[model samples]
Target: MRKFTIALDAMGGDFGPHISLSASSKSLQLHPNLFITIVGDAQQITPLLKKYQLLNHNRIKFVHAPETISMEDDPVSVLRHRSQSSMLVALQLVAKGEADACVSAGNTGALMLLAKHTLKTLEGISRPALVSALPNNRGGHSYLMDLGANLQCGCDTLFNFALMGSVLCEQVEQLSAPSVSLLNVGRESNKGNDTIKQCAEMLSATEFINYIGYIEANELFDGRADVVVTDGFSGNIALKSYEGMGRVFFERLQQAINTTWYSRLLGKVLNPIIKNQLKNLHPDLYNGASLIGLRGIVVKSHGSANESASFYAIEQAIKEIQWQIPACISARLESVLAERDCLSHE
Candidate 1:
């Protein structure tokens, strides 16, 4: 296997180096060819590295960043002031070609700002988007994009998102002509505002896109479409609502299971079956969201991720490196633009 290096923002998340370092250790164990550069305050990271017995590991490198970006820190303020922050350093490593990818569990706004500033977007991409997979009724996954990157997007931006998302699903999911759908208020042609209608028209006209009709929010996880496109506002709300509902469902089930001695006995007997069936709905399984359309790979983890989830984020970065996702998206966009040019001239 070809070796790849990842720069991790160790001090970005709620648990800081404690969680990041632990996840890095687990990742290194799983991927022997993987090397990690832990970026953060050396004073804090050094002790934890020693605790994890990875202080002198050959596969590990430490880059000290004097400052850190807090979850509450404004993106613009951090871009102006926190030059030596861990998050910035990690992204810079990718920009400078010192790392194959960068992974962070930091301020969403700050990370997006720094990633865009450091790495820039692809030639045709106006803004980077956050895309992740959601479990579907077909026992597979569907890709969703703009999960809180840009709250308001124009028709052009939405069109670009569909293209980007289509390429992602085609490459990562290895599906030919993956079906693409817009998340909207209704499926009928007459429904939705002007922006949605216009974006729908664009998608439908593009021969390169396998554009299906609109998908309502209720059908998000129905597995009818391979990729679902939406503005960040609606996508973010849908994602959070799904995650929240999963948590509530499991919590309520556990409560009922523990209500009485007979219930506890029944729960014990059904534990394995329940776990097997519900594994797909666990939030930890979908912890990493790729900030696509950037020049380099950037995977964002949930700020509240535990070691398991953080490791999943690292795995996500590794997969992107192997897949060469940026290159794929760029190539696909170029072809689509060429097709558009031909159509315009005719």
Candidate 2:
């Protein structure tokens, strides 16, 4: 009765209904009062829902939307023709106030375009950046922003990115005076290019942010800062590299254990411990990234997401709605910008 419902796109990701159904089963089981309106072709989703025995639940409803948005299709064109497409329908539900949030594992570009076009950005927000929560060696996690949204950015954009990332920490991470840092090659005050130098100055001069100096790549895993801000291009490459390194290490560890009898025995003993230690590094756990600064909370999961990943995304959407993160962020930004404007006048 809390009026918390999420609009999910059943046809978004690579695995489509399979992942969606599995995630839905888990989500519905965990939250009895929660409702989800899955948007997709009835012909495709009905069978899966029935097979999973989720068809009869009053809380679980299906909205008949038959079109699909392809990864290769033009984002604008797909949103136009595929008016009934699962992604568009899900977003529309959020825009129309029927759902609290929208979750999609579909084309990232298309989702951003539709979210911007449909719900529009918060007042004064230049662009919405894809932000993720990543594990830190110290403990818990940190927020990394502009992971895959903008490529070419100005110093002002980076400054705004820092503010947005901090707002997320305050709202989602519940951190007071969250430490903010810039991604750069060195910690020196005069390091790298003009962009880095200018951003360093801006961050140092910021009143709201707990401005830490430049953090190197190695410091990212060491928990050097709470919110790390960078352009989308650099942030994307860093995220991909982190994932790639984790996979390579996991596979190598498995292969080393299979080579001989003694090694196999040792591996069996250590595998469980190793897995427990590395659980945070799994893609399934961190697959969902929130497109911050939007009017509604939009969670973008990996395109190749499986059931586990899908479920995490849906769960995140639920929490975002509960926390009213989008609304809180908008208010925070407006306040911060207003304060800055008043100071400039003084």
Candidate 3:
């Protein structure tokens, strides 16, 4: 059996040590052989480890990282200046082959910037996109890419996201020739902005993808597409809006019930079922957006991720490693890039 040690950023999220401590403790239980190196100030993490009763594990080690990078810090400047920041140290460990991969609930931009600079991108990959899996109301989950990494993307880049995301779907979701869709204003061939329209045309022509034409925003939760590719700006807005609306929808439902005794009785009757449904749609289940196009697995958890979310993210990372997803995607991408180069020569 191949052994792997994960480097966790102990001071990454908004909830601070509580989230990190909980994630690490639960992760150890999930993978008995899994080793973790928690990087952060001992003053903050040591007590939490004790509270979680994880202070005695020989497989767990704490590495003191003096500097901490806040969410507001500039990505490039902090990477260069704050050499000892916990997030940077965790990434460096992976870059130097000290750890198999890194999991961080930190600034998304900083994680991308640091990973690109340190570990470098895979062959023929220009810009790495953040790809995430969201729970579909229909069944299972759907994967979306360029979630927020690049604000704008070209047709070729959009195609790459589809190819990369397809590989992820196969490796992680255990799906084959998964249906790929372009996020656009309508399902028609000639809808959406110029960028989306052009990308749709390009995708339609691609031999690599199982392109299902354009998918409208309303169809996102309907599971019309297994892999949706779009520019980061649009994708990010759509994702955040879905999350916000999901919360608001449930909140209003609760408020409506609490306002009346009759409605409250109905709520009690359906409360357990509704709670289970909401749990299925929670953001934590969809934690860890993969930085596709990178040479290794780099998962970005929500900056506000809690312990359970972090644990799931780590489990996903472990699956990626076991499946050798990065290596598989690299081979497919090389083939695509080669074909493009041949066409350009003609």
Candidate 4:
């Protein structure tokens, strides 16, 4: 396999250097062809390096970025003032072609702002969408886009999302023609507002899209479609609600299992099975959210990610690198747009 160099924001997450640097060690071990440059304060990174015993590995290196953009930092303000911050520096590595991709567990708003300023969106893409995969009924994954990115998207913006989302599902998941759905309240054609209705029309007319019509929120994980496209507003609400439900469901399940001695004993017997199910739904397993439509690859790990979660993000970036995902999206996008433009004029 071809080697990939990753630029990691080493000090920005809730767990700081310990989790991020340790994740680097895990990634390097898993992929021998991978190289990582951890961007953060030398003072903070060195101890973690020593603790993890990762300094001697030539594939792992560091760049001193003394500043950090905290979770509470204003995205616009950080972009203007924190030029030397680890988040910005790490993104810069990807823009400068020094790194194949950048992975961060940092301020989401700040990362999005910095990425747009540094790399810009791809040609024909209106905006970058925050996308992640979720386990579906088919024992495979479904891609959801505009997770919290474009809050108030237009019909065209929603159309762009479907285009980007379908390409993403195809490139990353190796789906030849991924089935896509527009998330809405009802499955009827007339259910959604003007934007979604019109967007659906566009999707239907597009010969390239494997458009599967409307899907309700309840069917999100039913394997009804391989990809779900929505504006950031509703998509964000649904995503958070889904995540909250998963946590609450497992907590309640555990409580019920421990209600009595016999039940507790049964719980222990079923512990491994429960753990496996939890692993499938765990936020850590799906920690990385790809910022698609950008000129370079950027994977956003959840801010609260631990070592394993952070490693998942790194591995995601490595896969994108191996697949040349961005290039594939760009090529597919150019074809789709060009074909549309031709029909528009004709």
Query: Number of the top candidate by TM-score?
Result: 1
True-structure lDDT of candidate 3: 0.85
TM-score between candidate 3 and the true structure: 0.93
Give the local distance difference test score of model 1: 0.92
Estimate every model's Cα lDDT from 0 to 1.
0.92, 0.85, 0.85, 0.88
**Index of the highest-lDDT prediction:** 1
Screening candidate 3 with a backbone cut-off below 3 angstroms (N, C-alpha, C), the clashing residue pairs are none
lDDT tens digits, residues 92-116, model 4? 9999999999998898889998999
Tell me the spans in candidate 3 whose CA falls farther than 4 Å from its real position.
Answer: none
Per-model TM-score versus the true fold: 0.98, 0.95, 0.93, 0.96
Writing each residue's lDDT as its tens digit, candidate 1 over 1-346 gives 7999999999878876799989999999999999999999989988999999989999999999999899899999999999999999999999999999999999999999999999999988999999998999999889998899899999999999999888888888789999999998889999998999999999999887899989998898899999999999999999999889988999999999999999999999998999999988888888899999999999999999999889889988888898899999999889988988898999
- Please give the range of 10 consecutive residues that has the lowest summed lDDT in model 1: 9-18
Give the per-residue lDDT of model 2 (tens digit) for 9-102.
Answer: 8888887677888898899899977899988999999899888888998888889988888778888798678788889989999999998889
Task: Single out the weakest 10-residue window by summed lDDT for candidate 4.
Answer: 277-286
Instruction: Output the lDDT of residue 190, model 2.
Output: 74
Of the two candidates 1 and 2, the one with more favorable lDDT, higher being better, is 1
Per-residue lDDT value at 136 in model 3? 89
Candidate 4 Cα RMSD (Å): 1.4
